[model samples]
Target: MIELRSLTKNFEDKKVLRGINSVFEGGKCNLIIGRSGSGKTVLMKCIVGLLTPTTGNVFYDERDFCVMTKRERTLLRREMGMIFQSAALFDSLTVLENVMFPLDMFSDQSYKERTRRAKYCLERVGLLDALSKSPGEISGGMQKRVAIARAIALEPKYLFCDEPNSGLDPKTSLVIDELIYSITQETGTTTIMNTHDMNSVLGIGDHILYLHEGEKEWEGTKDEVLGSTNERLSDFIFASDFLKKVKAAGAKS
Candidate 1:
């Protein structure tokens, strides 16, 4: 689990995050969503130690992250896994090699053990057949699956995904969403994702944080989102014509 206490971030004179407080529970998909300039990305960065908070505390399973020493923070990072907006796989490496990269860099396991672990992760993602293929040879969705396999190869206690469903068809997006949700439940990892995809919001958002103009405007579960009377949230939710049409169809039914 992760907890934020009065978190805030400022960029020179522009404030990116206000005094936000929230709890991200483990074994669930905690999502951060908002408009392009609403600061969701900044908030995720602060929580992951990529950016420093101006005034507040970030705790990982009750350990204060702000006060940790450099070595301590480095060690703590080994327990966390990250998936970028892009698949971020190396074109020069095979899919299996990409998954094995973390194990080779950090794990004390023997080469055979690392190979076994990498293959297992690939199998879990249903990509064992793509083991020898390079990133350039696969489709976007397959590349994303490889990225997921690599992220989980270390069996991390926490997982962070930034737009994991970006740049994919709706069908592929749903596949990625279900994969992340299942992985979180299976491993009991504290999973936090920064995304603007509304499909993802309703699909696997166990906990949702809505930011508006650098402030936490609302927070709730996916089931409560449609019933919310918050004007801004309602506007944001129905902004797309597809969703508006769905709402109208539901009302008619």
Candidate 2:
């Protein structure tokens, strides 16, 4: 499990996160949801050590990430995986090579061993046939799959996704959501996703953290979200008439 204690971040003059405290349980799809500029991206970056928090502690399974030595932090990075908004696969490399990149960079395994591990991860994400194909040759959804395959190649203990379904059609988005959800469950990784995708929130969001401006507005499970009494959360989530009706119907049931 990952826990954020009084997490606060500032960009010189502007504070982006303010004393945000939350727990991301292991083996669950923990979602950070909010409108653009709500500071979700900043929070995720801080948790993943991309940005330094101005004040607070980020604990990875009880170890304080902020205080870890450079070597220790490097070692901790091997236990973490990230899927970016753009799917971030190397265009120069084939799908298999992209999946094997982490293992090649970090693992002491032989070529044959690394290839075996990469193949297993690719197969897990249903990309066996596309191993030799470059990232440019695949569809956007398939590219995301390759990213997911690469993220899990090292069997990371923690997974972070940033707007994972961005630019995909609704159907394809749902497919990616299910794939991520399944991987998190099967591997028991502490998965934290930063997204504005409401479909993902209702689909795989076992734990939801709602941010408004620079503070945590609310936190709960997906089921509890529909019935949430927090007006700001309701306004943000059920913004459309269609979604409002859905929430109303869910409440009635």
Candidate 3:
């Protein structure tokens, strides 16, 4: 599990995150959701150690990650897997190579061992036959799958996804969502996803963190979210016609 304690991030003089506290349980899809510029992205970056927070601590399985030395952090990173907003695959490399990149850089595994593990990871993501394919030769959804395969190649204990469903059709998005959910269950990874996709919120958001202009406005499960009395959350989530129908149906259900 991951814990955020009074987490705060600043840029120049502007504060993006403001003393937020939350618990991201392991073996579940913990979602950070908000409107654009709600500081959700900043919070994710801090949790992933990509950005240094001005104040506060990020604890991974109870250890404070904010103060770790470079080597300590690098070792910690070995346990982490990340899928970015874009698949961010190395286009020049084959799908298998992309998945094997982590092991190549971090593991003592031989070429044959890396290839075997990478192939297994690809199969897990339903990309078994695409090993030799380049990123540019595939569709957006397929590229996302490759990214996921790469993320899990090392069998990481934690998974972080940023806007994972961006630029995909609804069906593809749901597939990716289900894949992540299944992976979390299989690996017991502490999964944190940053997204504005409400469909994803209902589909796999075991824990939801709602951010409002840099503050943690509310936190709850999917079922609890429908009954929220917090106007900001209600408006932010139920504002769209699509979400309105979903929530209305949720109310009836």
Instruction: For residues 32-120, write the lDDT of model 2, one tens digit per residue.
Output: 99989999999999999999999999999999999999999999999999999999999899999999999999999999999999999
Model 1 pairs whose backbones collide: none
Tens-digit lDDT track of model 1 for 6-82:
99999999999999999999999999999999998889899999999999999999999999999999999998998
Tens-digit per-residue lDDT, 1-253, candidate 3: 9999999998988989999999999999999999999998889999999899899999999888998999999999999999998899998899999999999999899999999999999998899998898999999999999999999989999999999999999999999999999999988999999988888988898999999999999999987887899999999889899879987897788
List the global CA lDDT of all models.
0.93, 0.95, 0.93
- TM-score of model 2 (CA atoms): 0.97
| Candidate 1 TM-score, C-alpha based | 0.97
Residue-pair clashes per candidate, as listed?
A: 0, 0, 0
* Alpha-carbon RMSD, each predicted model: 1.2, 1.1, 1.3
Off by over 4 Å in 1: none
- Give model 2's clash tally: 0
The top-ranked prediction according to lDDT is: 2
Each prediction's TM-score versus the true structure: 0.97, 0.97, 0.96
Model 3 alpha-carbon drift over 4 Å, by segment: 249-253
